[model samples]
Target: MSNLTRTQEKELKEAFDIFDRDHSGSISARELKAVFKNLEISASDQDIKNAMKQMDINNDGEISFSEFSRVMEAQFYRKYTHEEIRAAFDHFDKDKSGYISADELRMTLSKMGKTFRKDEVDKMIKSIDKDGDGRISINEFMDLLN
Candidate 1:
């Protein structure tokens, strides 16, 4: 925690906030489970209970932000495999339109406040790729993710 830069801390806070659904300053198993569901993780209840047991850190049945941050930090050094990065990209892809170029990536992320269907995303990506004349490489996307 002491070695984390301010930006890293902010990123961790943002991630924790996503799981703290009730604004309770802590994350519960239900909240964690809901987020996992959204992320398309097929974790079982027992798996979640084990995760809670590992993350809560205080045996309190909930993960405080501090606990969450510590666990995230502990896991941060691992490099994402291609499959892992692709899975993360797929999670945000929403419409299954596949990857787009950098310009479309920025545009699509900017419009995240609105929902886009498969056809819409496909249309947008096709138009952008037609103009840009190239697609985004997985390595490039992985760099963006990093």
Candidate 2:
């Protein structure tokens, strides 16, 4: 495997620090909850449970820093590319009006045959709609992507 970039490495280290509250080389559910809370992203109890299930590869109810970093790196790599990161605002700017609307986003993903429950979509939209405008602009979309 390739080494992480300096920025990614630093981010992983900081995340580890936050998630590793006890400095015991592992993260418990409480630490995970703190991380999510600190980011101001509201995670449902089920979401936290599911995350614990997925991140705790050994079924130990806790995640080692290395495991946590690996899971995060895998997910981050799947969603981002050098070129996409460089031109994301332009690439996902489907409206061509220099913005991304919720409708545009839903339509684009729908065209790809993806599926999401109405509640799921609503939750995601709510998170990204920082202005409460019922629409997502390019800047907002970029923030969500990051």
Best by lDDT: 1
Clashes of 1: 0
| Model number with the top TM-score | 1
Stretches of candidate 1 off by over 4 Å are 100-137
Residues 1-146, candidate 2: write the lDDT tens digits. 63688878786876676567678888888878876665455898889899998889888889987778778887555666546654655544565776666666665545333445666666767888888876667667666656
- Could you tally the backbone clashes for each prediction? 0, 0
**Residue 120, candidate 1: alpha-carbon lDDT:** 61
Give the clashing residue pairs of candidate 2, or none: none
Candidates' RMSD to native: 6.3, 12.6
Clashing pairs in 1: none
Off by over 4 Å in 2: 80-146
lDDT for each residue of candidate 1 in 45-116, tens digit (9 for 90 to 100): 999999999898889999999999888986566677889899877655555667554445544444332345
- Give me the overall lDDT of model 2: 0.70
